[model samples]
Target: MNEKKSVTRLDSTYMDQYDAHVERQGRKKKRLLRRLALFALLTLIVTSSLAIYHVQQRMVYAEKKEEYEQLQEEMGSLKESEENLREEIELLNEEEYVLEIARSNYFFSKEGEIIFKLPNEEPSY
Candidate 1:
């Protein structure tokens, strides 16, 4: 076992006042640190939520943009089909076009007209 010397302290009004002041300062420092920590946590939570919201909005915007492009392409194709159908309707309204289709498909003949079926053969080159 080791022996240690004990020291004696003087009791005075100045020492007591200084100790009280030191204790008050320590408490003030602790309160300041706690406030700073709480503020930092609040800032982190707000920033994280904002970042997540920003990312989700960007994804929704991208999907909408892609859908709009697809719809535009489909609209173009539909417009082309409508134009083709209109042209076909005009053709079918003509008497000559109707007669030609009947002559070709239904073996129809005008006066002194002959119909022949020829073999479709490829020549070996």
Candidate 2:
């Protein structure tokens, strides 16, 4: 009877140690789970922030592209105007073209030519 009681006591002590070990393991598992949840949340936040930043960058690039196209169109118009002005300058440098312009715009004639004068009508007011 004495030996049986000693064996029973020893079994109970071992069972208590086993239970403590299981509790420690459970606490460790809970801690690991909490760390994993925190890591996942942080990852989600970083990914979302990066996504938003990329979207904004794309929007800025699109606006700049539109502005560049507008500037290119204005440059084309300015180039055409510059070419027209250059041609006019070349024409004006020639004496014949200058004389033609003067004759047409000012009605100029060679020396000793007849001049016609037209009478103007009186104003009503």
Candidate 3:
């Protein structure tokens, strides 16, 4: 009877130890899983923010590029107008050109010239 009781006690103690070890292992696994989930969530948030930033930068770049192209076109037109104005200034410096403009715009004729006013014919649409 004494031997049987001692064997039974040993068996019970072994079972208790096994149960405790299983509980510890389970807790460790749960902690590791929680850490992994937190890390994954952080990674997702960071990547999403970076993606959004890049998209915004691309949009801004497109708008700026369009503005630059428009400015280039405007500058080209302004340069052409400046050339035309410079030509007109040069022509105005000539005496003959000035007299021509005065006769055409002000209807001034040389001393003994007969002036005729003609009406323009238009289609009565």
The lDDT for every candidate, in the order shown, is: 0.96, 0.91, 0.94
For each candidate, what TM-score against the reference?
0.74, 0.75, 0.74
Candidate 3 lDDT over residue span 1-125, tens digit each: 46654344455887899989999999999999999999999999999999999999999999999999999999999999999999999999999999999988899999999788777787688
The count of backbone overlaps in candidate 3 is: 0
lDDT of 1: 0.96
Cα RMSD for candidate 2? 7.3
lDDT of each residue in 16-71, candidate 2, tens digit only: 99989999999999999999999999999999999999999999999999999999
**Can you rank all candidates by lDDT, best first?**
1, 3, 2
User: Mind giving the per-residue lDDT tens digits that candidate 1 earns over 1-125?
Assistant: 68797888779999899999999999999999999999999999999999999999999999999999999999999999999999999999999999999998899999998999776898778
